[model samples]
Target: MTWVKLFLGSLAVSLSLVATAASMPDGCNCFCVIAGRNTTVDGSVMLAHNEDDSGEMMLNMYAVPRLNGNNAYLWGEFPGTSVCDHFLNEWGVAIASDGCPSREDREDVTDGGVLYEVRLTVAQRAHSAREAVKIIGHLVETRGYQASGRTYVIADPHEGWICSVVKGRHWVAKRIADDEVMALPNNYIIDEVNLADTLNCYGARDVETYARERGWYDPERDGRFSFKKAYCDPYYYTYEHNVIRQLCAQQYLTGRNDLVPDPDTLPFAVRPNRKIGLADLMQIMQCHGENSEHKFVYKRERPWNHPVGICTDVTVLSAIFQLRADRPREVGCVMWVCAGRPCTEHYIPWYLGISRTPDCWRRYASAAQAVKDHFTAVEHKRDQWPHHIYWKGVDRWASYATDWHNGIAAVQQARDKRQAKACKAFAKMDKKLQKYYDPRTLQVKDREAMVKSINAFTEKLYR
Candidate 1:
């Protein structure tokens, strides 16, 4: 009887762990525009991302040190994980990823590092877009890419690259053309990789051979080895939401009415008719599929249309990285981060050179410590006081907006007015700081002042 009870308890614990792992949230979207394709309104290359996950997860900012004595990198990390979904390093390298689950993922569960681990490794070690591609390829081939597939958008001031990692360590990456712009939802976009174009393409040595062994490709019948057709789970291709989002992205970028959503024929990248800017990117990220007649309708009965929008229920944070090569490193890179839903929340600029995060943005170790700190700074008692002040406030505001439902239009109008005013003020302050302070002469006090000013502005938005 004692042995039977012990065995039952162990079995229950094992099942609980499996259930928890299976429920992990997954979804994200990222877009990149090269320098030539940008409007130069801010004189920088831009990359934007929408990080969707379990709505309850707390998204916090982190500055992690590189073990190899390189420059420390700043990233927006979720609680309990060292892997960063969005990150920018001192060398102007910035990267973001989207989840791409495939059929092969179910069969291949080797020792390759998980998604977060692979992302963290790339963020810590790579300095250039090309270097980042090589590093990810090497890591996947050697250690194995353990998670479902993923698509990474890595960029610097000079260029951008899209790398796709699949199950069993097979991967491929292609550099975005100088004048091209590309966007990725939760699916593999890279098709036939050109092995001969070493400068622009990188892939595993056994990519084709492995696909052949798996009976996924036929060299004699299929003219060339198509990565997407071979590795992307056929079931995902049937998902209407994936196709809807991909179509929406292309329509937004190209502004072409004739374009249709066909996975087989959609170009990986294209040159927009008009140069895109940071503001344009923001609008795209905030898209709710409004213009499409086939998708979301303003007051339609289809609740499914909600998930197809760029802004979704589970979006915890969104950001756009502006990397300027002409400006000094300290002031050149800026991350425009929105704590909650992009549609309701405005972006706050955080400079890459900042030494410390504002108290509100920093996460504490425990609830007790958070309370103690709150008491120490009692002046902020009227505002948020707990350890997760920033997150809690954002969550509350997001809830209010969401609950408004059909009445959200009024809320958005008010928020947009305030956001516009705030944007103007931030632009003025950023310009003044850029002109007044030289990176070489900037002191700790200057940085502190900047942080305080930004924090105050952010607090005003919540109020």
Candidate 2:
């Protein structure tokens, strides 16, 4: 009786394993990196679902997580298992070719293809791309396959951003059913995608253009342009292409810079060609933090109408500066309000051309530490009570004169802390988390403690 019980228990465990395996999306293509090879990948296609978009139709790939900084690569290109919908957003199976697409020009692959659908599987999500690649070999050996022109599979070259199977390119229309998959020619032909699109997609063109213009492409300069330049200025790029606008404004107003066309001289700073003058440009650059777009509407009581294609950070700055230049009385009102204060009221300039960033501003770790230190200092000032207790619902109370001084001190302390401990903590967490913890389950023992720790780390920011 004891032996039978043990056997049954063993059988139950085996059945559970089988069920779990079966429940995972089965019969999908997988890829992985070979040992000691940085660029090459090996994998197999499980053509178990002979028909397109029928009978457990699923596709998956194993690749490296992209390295973003320095040498940017796509996230899917990195070492990881990625579950991609074969029917990309219900548009048909897309096969990205060997290169990344440009942000502005790359056409959507989904818009033209015959639609095929596939489901996602846990194995695809749970396992690393490398492990998936290893298992795919055996899965393919067990399940015989069929030819579907729609199934476009290719390896990625180191330079290639993607191994795309675009809908209108390289593949023919095919029907995928539960029992059998059919392949038929659809007269679709492949075309060479433009490199500019690839550069723009991964965020390179503007920097490339800027670097060449600024003579920043010198090999002696460590063979690299500024990382910040190469990466889209998120402040500007996040909204409209404000860098282009800023450049245009500076060039047209200054008239001597040889970047874009110059604007016609006009009575107002805004030119007929929509270029703004030097004064307005400087004001915008100073006040709006270089990349700011004046998309935010001021209160209704403010006398400002949206400018035509000129409603940007520069426009507002131009308007204010022009007012100050032409009408001194208006300028006096602003200066009166802004003068006398130690820091907040003063017009300090922040520019992108600075050679060094304050240690506090460099990374999140330092920034956080700075914040934590400030909170400590501020708490001490507030009679050892949390600021939240006093300034809880007070909107912009920190800007008040008395409160402002305290806030500034607290911020400086935070910034100092960020430069010291924050950086160390961030580096330690990065190393430890990558080594010891599964990133998915990041919950801590106490939520408030975690929040406090995080707040203390980041509170030292200047902006």
Candidate 3:
């Protein structure tokens, strides 16, 4: 383990101090669900994510068709933004994250700290979830993390890892057990750091010593070294709205109303009473927290200022990754992506082997252009949104939210009908397609033919 031993100005990270990230609200949060293979009905590792953000944001989905040399992947892109992107590569590895603010305020960054480049490197370079975590550790330790903090939920076919990062050179990652499920909000949920458990953990070597040196921790007073307790901001960690969203998922799986909204009280991960399915996980991600034991009074006009609940008024997009090892990665990995809010838009299946995404998904500028435009470009205005799929769902969601309870029924009815059709179409496509690829080498026997079929099927779903 190569641990970079550079410590900048030492200042005690105050529990009272608040953290701010690049162009995001303090209350903003994203929800991610990691279901280990043994906990799911089909025994496939499931990772579900809802990208909660507001503004005239745009989402673009495109496949990087360079699998021969570099890795090919389906990039879930948010143009002109640093932290709000997701990816699924050719190896069945998928990555998404929540902006979990930490207590580290020291400016230890080199090259403006690593932000957008972190996830992109994982997508382009990593061969497995473990490799992805190692890549993140190297980048953060050497370059430093740019955001307040973030917990990246990365998973491959066989397992899932929740990699929690601080604002500086300290970080930790833990693997989810096969029988457990983890639901993460904006707060840091990884409390126990067992770096000795090398098989299930990977992190900085001086994670505890650095905190102690900075006066952030004292083993005499704090007992064992809790990375989360020493580094996470108390205000953000216990923020009512975000933790409630985490509890909502817990409630559904445990069927227990007594589960508290606090992270300390709630189990780090819950064992579901029964095996979970795609639909069950979908319902969990779509929750508005209406049925939970605790209720929230809408502080702003927008629900969670339009970004709370597992679902939200400001959710630009959502993804449910069904990652399996039973077959070749091309046929094994699939992302059920919804353009906008889960409540308003239907989730369309996007297979990993597809040659290309629909034109509507690629109407934005190229990948290199988007990265350059991340900080320089102006936000797109509302009226301009109707031209693309992401904004169309945003516009539709905003309209339905006017009537809310009354307006949601008809829209959901039509969306469900379309959703059922998509599921049926995907089933037929998978059955016809799975046999053509070799599972041993993760290669397709007939790449061009399979690509053609995938593109045609994806086009039908888009239309």
Best by TM-score: 3
Indicate the worst ten consecutive residues by lDDT in candidate 2.
330-339
Top candidate (lDDT): 3
What value of lDDT does candidate 2 attain over all alpha carbons? 0.22
> Each candidate's root-mean-square deviation in Å?
8.1, 24.6, 5.1
The 10-residue segment of model 3 with minimum total lDDT is 5-14
Whole-model Cα lDDT of every candidate shown, in order = 0.63, 0.22, 0.79
- lDDT for 372 (candidate 3): 35
- For model 1, what is the C-alpha lDDT against the true structure? 0.63
In model 1, the number of clashes is 1
Clashes of each: 1, 42, 0
Q: What's the C-alpha lDDT at position 245 in model 2? A: 34
The residue-by-residue lDDT of candidate 2 on 1-79, one tens digit each, is 2212222323222222211111112121111100111211111111101111111111111111112111111111100
Superior candidate under TM-score, 1 versus 2: 1
Model 3 alpha-carbon drift over 4 Å, by segment: 1-26, 67-69, 303-308, 364-378, 381-386, 438-443
Q: 1 or 2: which has the higher lDDT?
A: 1
Instruction: Return the TM-score for each candidate structure.
Output: 0.80, 0.19, 0.90
Error of 1 at 390 (Å): 3.5
Model 1, residue pairs in steric clash: 112-144
